[model samples]
Target: MTTLQNEPAACAHAELAQLRIRVIALENLVISLLADTSERQLAIARDMATYISPRPGFTPHRPTVHAAAQIIHLVGRARHFRPMAPSRRSR
Candidate 1:
């Protein structure tokens, strides 16, 4: 009886672990895609972060604002992975 009771919990734990792995993989894929984008596109994405920013004041919804901030943070992190352009003086 104890084993049967624990089975569902174990299965749920396994499923949660798999979901975490998938989320990490998706995040890595997005970072790679962002890294490959042109500078112009990256700049546009940075601009989008600003657009998503919540205006200062009391608000009923907080999760939406937090998610937007997270997105902005992710964009900033992905930008760090972008390759630096070679200087023209190197030619």
Candidate 2:
């Protein structure tokens, strides 16, 4: 009886875990694509993150706010993959 009651909860937990894995995979793909894109496109993506960010003192849904922050953080990570600029001394 207790096992039957816990079964649904276990299923739900498993589904949630799968969803999290998918989200992480998607984030990594986006980071890779962004890293390969032009600087102008990357800047546009950064602007989009800023655009979606919640304003001060405004109550936005938690997930929405989190997504915005994730986008910005992903962009930062993508930036790290970009090639380093040539030093002035090398020019």
Which candidate should be chosen as best, given lDDT against the real structure?
A: 2
lDDT of 2 by residue, 7-78 (tens): 999999999999999998998999899888898998888788778878888888788878888888998899
Error of 1 at 13 (Å): 0.7
Our tally of clashes for model 2 stands at 0
| lDDT string, candidate 1, 6-79, tens digits | 99999999999999999889878878888888878877877776666666774535776676676667677787
**What TM-scores do the predictions have?**
0.70, 0.77
User: Cα RMSDs of all predictions?
Assistant: 3.0, 2.9
In order, how many clashes per candidate?
0, 0
Looking at model 1, report the run of 10 residues with the lowest lDDT sum.
Answer: 52-61
Reference-based lDDT, residue 76, model 2: 88
Off by over 4 Å in 1: 43-60, 88-91
Best by TM-score: 2
For candidate 2, report its TM-score.
Answer: 0.77
Question: Weakest 10 consecutive residues, lDDT, candidate 2?
Answer: 82-91
